[model samples]
Target: MSTEIELPPGDQSLLLVDDDKAFLTRLERAMQKRGFSVRSADTVADGLAAVEADPPAYAVVDLRLEDGNGLDIVSALHSRRPDARAVVLTGYGNIATAVTAVKLGAVDYLSKPADADDVINALLATGEAPPAPPDNPMSADRVRWEHIQRVYELCERNVSETARRLNMHRRTLQRILAKRAPR
Candidate 1:
């Protein structure tokens, strides 16, 4: 069975920015089906350019992009269109980053794997009430593993550099990265 997402009635365009090509493509289609006119960018440069050319009414930005942080995109969106609503999605969640995202004008910070429904709800929020917290938050181990993966990617998948930055043995970091993400 398939469920259809119903977005609020309007012709508002949404911008989706993520470095993962597959994810960006899939999300663009999903958002379109939900009734949004979607614009997608797979890099920070492209995202910023899209925002400059045409600021979207809403935006879903990945926290990490190939060229720069997703927060940069949010900041640009906010500057161009202060009323625009934005959400930040990240695989690696932490308090500091979450606060930073909000201060940069993201309406909400969501962990990755957020479905189309979740993104819509976040964007359409009235800002009068905070959304309910997740029923199941990430376990500490899961958070750790996600952080390691984020660092790994930031280092361009160089085990030595990732290990050095994390201050851990290269083999240990490698083993952790090799395993599937913790539940």
Candidate 2:
């Protein structure tokens, strides 16, 4: 028993940009079910082209695409359509990147695996009131682990590079990576 989300009255055109084909397809179908006319792009170039061809009223863009960063798309969308609402989705979420996304005109920054409901709420939120706290926020250990994992991934899984970038001992990072994620 879930309450239906009421979209703000306007164009329902939406652009979905993500390198993950399966996730993109899933989100596309879900948004369509909720009445958005969805168009999708799997690369930064394609996303930019789509935005240029037709600016969408709403956009859900992944932070890291195979070809380039998704912020490019967000920036282009904002430039083309200042009234558009956009959300930045990422697997490697951090405070700095979230701030940058907001500054670049994203209405919200959501971590990956966000459901259709969460995305819809973000797209429609008026920002007049603060959002409620998460029911089960990640623990400090979990947050640290996630950050380390993100760095490791960004460093292309090179232990030395990740350790140097994080300023952490190689052994420490290796041990942390070896262990299972904290609750």
After superposition on all CA atoms, how large is the RMSD of candidate 2?
2.9
The lDDT values for all models are: 0.87, 0.91
Taking the tens digit of each residue's C-alpha lDDT, what string does model 1 give over 1-183? Answer: 124546666647999999888888988998887788989989999999999999999999999886889999999999999989999999878999999999999999988877776777788878788875555667889878878887888889999999999999999997898899999
Candidate 1 whole-model C-alpha lDDT, 0 to 1: 0.87
Per-prediction TM-score to the true structure, in the order listed: 0.78, 0.78
Model 2's alpha-carbon lDDT is 0.91
lDDT value, residue 54 of candidate 1: 94
lDDT (10s digit) by residue, model 2, range 1-183: 224777777899999999989999999998988889999999999999999999999999999999999999999999999999999999888999999999999999998767787788889888999765554666888878878887898889999999999999999999999999998
